[model samples]
Target: MKFRRKKSGYAVIEILLAAAVFVTIGTSIVYLLIDSGYSNLQGRDRVLAANFAQSGLEATRNIRDSGFDKLTIGNHGLALQNGSWAFSGESDIDQSGRFSRQIQISAISADRLLVTSNVNRIAGISRPLNITFSTYLNNWNKTTLLPPSWNTPQIVGIGSTGETTGNRNPFGIFVLGNYAYLVADQPSSTGSEFFIFDISNPQTPTLTGKVLTGKRVYSVFVSGNYAFLTTQAQGSTRPELVVVDISNPATPTIVSRTSFNGNNYAKDIVVVGNYAYITTLNSNSREFIIVNVTDPVHPVTTPVGSLELGSNVNALNINGNYAYLATANDSGEIRIINISNPAVPTLVKTYNNPGLADATEVLFSNDKLFLSTLTNSGTNPNFVILSLNPSDLSIAVIGQTQLAGNINGIALDEAGNQVFTATSLSSQEFVLLDITNQAAPVIKSSLNLIGAAVAINYNGSYAFMAVNDLIQQLFIIGQGQ
Candidate 1:
């Protein structure tokens, strides 16, 4: 009679319900714990990566200070390889006649090798460095006599002692190799002179020479011994393309001059290998023309390539076999062209951007194409990096950086790792960007040029800027010992 009550174990439905509730609670708790653990790991990994990047930078500085002259690729710190990190080095030349070393480091993750850092060094001339082993650091300031060979930069603004307020403005600047030249649009009462400056001494840049032109010089391109000037001619809609022999840095003589009756406004010109690629908006034709300038004096028009664009071509940049052109009055995109065939340049691709792009400049560096948008998103600027497949001529937007001012002109070191941009829409300064990581470009520092900088060109070590009043100034940037 006793145990017989046969304790009918709890009903099947009740037991099943209890088990279901327990399983649900356990699953939620496990998920939360896993998520938290992953988050913590990610944060720690990021911190470690940053520290590693900074360490690599310091290592480069040490090597440079130690007088390891001519450091190139494959010459990196072993500490970087000890961890999940890697780096590459390159030498860059700026317009200021200074040598710069660019080192890029990346972090190795489970799925990706994320680029995390860039280090720039101002490589001093390769001379016998004086070093002594000591426990104390030497005071560099003790030396009152600065290096006589080193040069600095000064900003020059528009002068109106007795002229109209807005008569002439510095519109363009060009550097004939290491020398600098400034061009003013329709100078005030003064002739249309290309004011040349001696940048050998960057700080106190001396105005070397001034040459009068047939028309207002809009843009210029410099070859080995010549400075090609693009002029905006009046009366005749067609602009004159003049080539001046720049063998003499101070005084340049016109070697060849050609007037295109069809194209009225020639925007820019670029010389590559042995040919000059000119971009212009012909008043009558209403298209961009690619003219042949292999023969400077008698520049003949070859098979002209035209793309159906809305506005005139404003900026053109070339690297290797491709030509990047920017068209549109205030807002536009960059068109990629295959210029392998000098006579017949073919259109490869086009990128229609929504950003308010006025003067777009492009440069190729570190296997990436950098597009600097002058005034995109109001006054805020941005540097767009495009991953370009040189083999197929295809481009994809990979990395970008938004900044504070409008960019006018852009320049880069030989490796395209260090980028310099001139601005006008804001404080009229020059910004330096570390583009070693093409996908995540960063603005490392900015210099207050104190003028509306219209154009910039770099030769690896120095930066040459075209500021107000058709004045060209040179700045030497980098950590100097």
Candidate 2:
């Protein structure tokens, strides 16, 4: 009558099953909590690493701004001691001790420094993470003007215009007939952004017309009754090629606009016949893009027409069936591309010389190539003249010369037998060279200006120079004896 003792207790197997279920659930919850905490920590570390890397870069810039002599080649860490900034030749970290920072200063030239900042962190969950930032710092304040002996040139009518502050930097210039077009940035102002000046009187350039592009223009090229302009790339606004009809320059209108993809930035352009050859920098590579502009109102880019180069292309020139490019980086190279077939451009040859590490501008005149280069780490020629054998793509160095500063722009007057160069670092901003003796070129005159000479264009009697100083924006240099 006991009913088998009512199975007084559940079977041992049942109790064991219940306990196993509870253990499994508890273990899963604990593991998930641990994983979430680890993920949060890893993300925090990454952000901290990035911040430290940026701080290192700023510190290096501060050192550079303080004095060029303060920078030296090697690993360095910024330390604040005695209410002053100092550089220590040791790897240092923040208060957390989890992030370490260091900097490397490499001398690219006498006045140029390539700074690299690095931050490292190790969290044990993965391999060490390293973040880096790099930039070139030039001694913009250093003025190394050598007194012009006897034949030094002089600037006659130097004038200043435009906004002195707030992103109103004048950058590009193009002269056609009696008018000169200037592209500048007017970020804080209204109205037209591009300006037209009546340079018919070089001594007094009067502003006659202006047109708005709604973006910062970096370059301008004129042909027929139209003007083609390239703008700087910003956040959501990609770099573009804009066509403006200037049949009546007083009232210019935008006709066509073309946008580029994948971090493409337009630096300079040259037009030949019905095609426009543009040199651009795409992320870390250089590209040559050819656009058919026969229809000015509807410019079309050639299909699969971009050719990649070794490094950034600074300046380009087109002659006959060839395009010469000045590609630069730690080293410089001159690339010749055959563009006889606009749709299919081909690289013909490349030339590299010891003194050609910083080729900034290139010009072709009468089978001779004028390459404006910068000296390397040591003493080398900053300007080079080469003879181009079109049939074989062979180049021979005819003459080489060194200047007190880096040459940023070059222009030639074939009829006058002169070469005008705009320099950045020298005491003289404008240099007039007599290339009449191709093999033994002589400097006719050098003039010191108020600002760094960035771009120059010669039109028979006068040289229009784009000056990048806070005050003076442009200078009209007349030929002086």
Candidate 3:
């Protein structure tokens, strides 16, 4: 039996061949699994970068819509998360104008891996929301307007020892000579009120006069001896523009009035050399109304230019012979119009912002146009500035900053060498900025205001603002304590 178990065995070559085949198959499987896993990881990183960018955009929009006005010139960071995923954003800038770049960095992560995004916010349209329109004439709060013995520490700065009321709203402000005028679109359930203050002294302000308007005075502009006002009418029958003669200062008389159709709404006014530029829009189009007011009583609509837009115009600014207008839509855009020849004006340039931007206001100074924008893409909102080439109508990025709240309007104190931004939501504080170097702006102060400010203006030494509230008051802003 032992001898029968002899040799019918396989050769060494056969055993070697089996071993080679097994090794080849195992190696192919290992390579396939590793390559597939790497490809998937790369795909996930790209998605994270995109999402981080979007988060920044959204946060900006939400702050703006909620009425927080803390935007300024500095790096602002925000973070967002969902489930095990998280996103973060940071924004910064240097210089201004068309070439100025605002770099926004966003970080996204899942588990131990991280991804990022860099975005640049361009120029566009922004306007204030939840405006306070009222009619009152005291430089005090509700207690000062008519009543309970007021006993709050006197506020130092601007024109007067007191402001009309504690609540700020009216959404409009104008400065002429040493005097500042504020409009309260809503006042004690009556109507809008115009409060005048002598801001000759930046540290100690004084109240001058007050006028009660039958309607909400949405906008106000001062030129020479008159302060032109526009009211938000409830219907077509109400006149929009209510020209007030401020020659006497104490008594503001309505010299003339103008009305528009129910569909068209009058939002803002700018008084230039001898003309008044007004912005009006509806669901159809946004148009500029050029009115010849050499004779204030006989105001004539010299020329009206219509603009075609993807959305409505939110705010407008005029510097010299150019009109800088901000509009909102899927993409925010800034349109520059040459108003040298008002009758036959032309569009010189246009800039589209990178994300959803609702430009509340456009301000031009030091050859730059600052945009107060709101977005819903990130956690913290943004305040953007662009360089302007008035000659070619080219807009470049000059500088940008970010903030914690929604920014509505900005004011520049050239003499104080500072910039002030009004926030509408959360902490209603006037975020102060140092613009010693226009290219590199920074935060220097954060003065607290009483209400939601819709518009702000500065006359080198003093700051003027309008807020949203029942007792809409005009505030004489000073440096923060």
Candidate 1 regions with alpha-carbon error over 4 angstroms: 1-168, 234-238, 281-287, 301-308, 329-332, 378-381, 414-417, 469-481
Tell me how candidate 2 scores on lDDT.
0.74
Cα lDDT of model 1 by residue, 1-481, tens digit: 5565654566877888999999999999999998766654443333333334445455554443444332233333322345433333342222343323334323332222222233222333332211111011122223353452212222322221111222356667776544676666764445544666666655445666666675677788777777777777622344467787767766767777666565456678887765767676546553455666777766764424544455667788887778888766553467777777765677777766556665457776656777776566753446777787767766778878776666777887636566778876444387777867767778766655535677887766566776663122333333222
CA lDDT scores, all candidates in order: 0.58, 0.74, 0.58
Give each prediction's root-mean-square deviation over alpha carbons: 24.3, 15.4, 24.1
Best by lDDT: 2
- lDDT by residue for model 2 (381-461), tens: 677799988678789989877787778889997676678888886568888888777787778888777567878888776
Which of candidates 1 and 2 reaches a greater lDDT? 2
**Model 1: worst 10 consecutive residues (lDDT sum):** 129-138
TM-score of candidate 1 against the unseen true structure: 0.60
TM-score of every candidate relative to the true structure: 0.60, 0.65, 0.60
- Candidate 1: lDDT of 204? 49
Which ten-residue region of model 3 has the weakest summed lDDT?
Answer: 128-137
* 177-290 per-residue lDDT for model 3 (tens digits): 877787754444443367777767745456677766676676788887778887766244776677888887767777877664434566778888777777765456445567
